[model samples]
Each structure stands twice: as C-alpha cells, then as structure tokens.
Target: MLASGLQQPAHGMEAEENPYLEIVKRNAFDLTNTPTNTQQKAPEPLKANDIKLTGIYLRNGVERAAIALIEKDKKNTKPTYLQLAVGEKQGTVEI
Candidate 1:
C-alpha cells in the first residue's frame, strides 16, 4: 500500500484558520444602489466686515473708489476689487 503525506483538516478548523475568508464577508455590500446628495444649499451672504476700502482715486472731475472683498479662509490670497463711482451702490453699501 502507498503512504499518503497529507492529512485531512477538521470541518470547521479550515475556516477559522483561513485569512481570506473574512474578505468576502467584509466586501458584501450593496453594489447597485448608492446614496448621494442631489440638492446643493445656497452660499452664505457676505457681511459688512468682509468688505474693505483699498484705495480712492480722482480723475478729470470724477471720483472712484477701489473696494476690496476679502475671501474667507485665505490669508495670503489677493482680495477681489470693485471700482465704483462716488455715488454708486453695490449690495447694501454706498460708495
């Protein structure tokens, strides 16, 4: 009779010793249905403190001001400017 080198493992012992067995169970999630947000909320309105007066200029009898709108959460970035005439109105502030 020929001698066999390998021995059969116990029924539940093979599953307990396997490392990749848990991978299948971990990835058993819903693949077809996914949750997502379709509606986006409106951005917050700028306040009075967020605006700054950078400079003022006078040319030919007309006066204008350079108004700077500071960006949120940025310190080193340049602010956006609006050139407005003496009596021009932007939002709630008058130049």
Candidate 2:
C-alpha cells in the first residue's frame, strides 16, 4: 500500500497582533518625518574606497580587526584607526 503526503500552507503574521512583526516595521526604514523648514540633508554613507584594513590580531581566543579611514586633510597625515570585533560598527560602516 502507498501513502500520500500532505503539505501545510505557510501562515503570515500580522503586525497588529504580534510585537515581533512590529519590530521589523520600525527598523526596516530610515524615514525622516521632519517639518518642511527645519529639515536638513542626511550625512553621506561611508564608502568602501575610503577604508583601509590596517591589522588583524587574536587576543585570548577571539579575533579583532583594525581599520583606518582615509581623509582628505593635509595637516592630519596620520590615519585614524578604528578597532572593532564581530558586529561592532564605526560611523556608518559595520564589521
């Protein structure tokens, strides 16, 4: 004798009923709802070309990464270094 398999339909969660669904709605967009006169332009996002990987090291057991930002200041010749691990973020860039 052969048995037939049945499939179940996937269900969607409504935001009004579930708090988890509402969390996505809040963070999904970067909407700026400001008055017409007081609104200012958002800062430009950091580009990949502006970043340089300086070093990577392991401490204890976890690994860490360092990066330098390439700025256009003639007086400040030294690169500004940022140390980050895992999900850490510097400015608009995340590691």
Q: List per-prediction Cα lDDT, in the order shown.
A: 0.75, 0.72
After superposition of all CA atoms, the RMSD between model 1 and the true structure is 11.3
Off by over 4 Å in 1: 1-49, 73-78
Cα lDDT tens digits, model 2, 1-95, are 45456535335744356657666678776556765578778999755446788899987787889898877544357777888888988786588
| Candidate 2 local Cα displacement, residue 65, angstroms | 0.7
Error of 1 at 14 (Å): 74
Tens digits of lDDT, candidate 1, 1-95 = 55486656436878788887777668777443555767889988755446888888987788889888876677578877788998899776687
lDDT of 2 at 86: 81
Each model's RMSD to truth, in Å? 11.3, 21.2
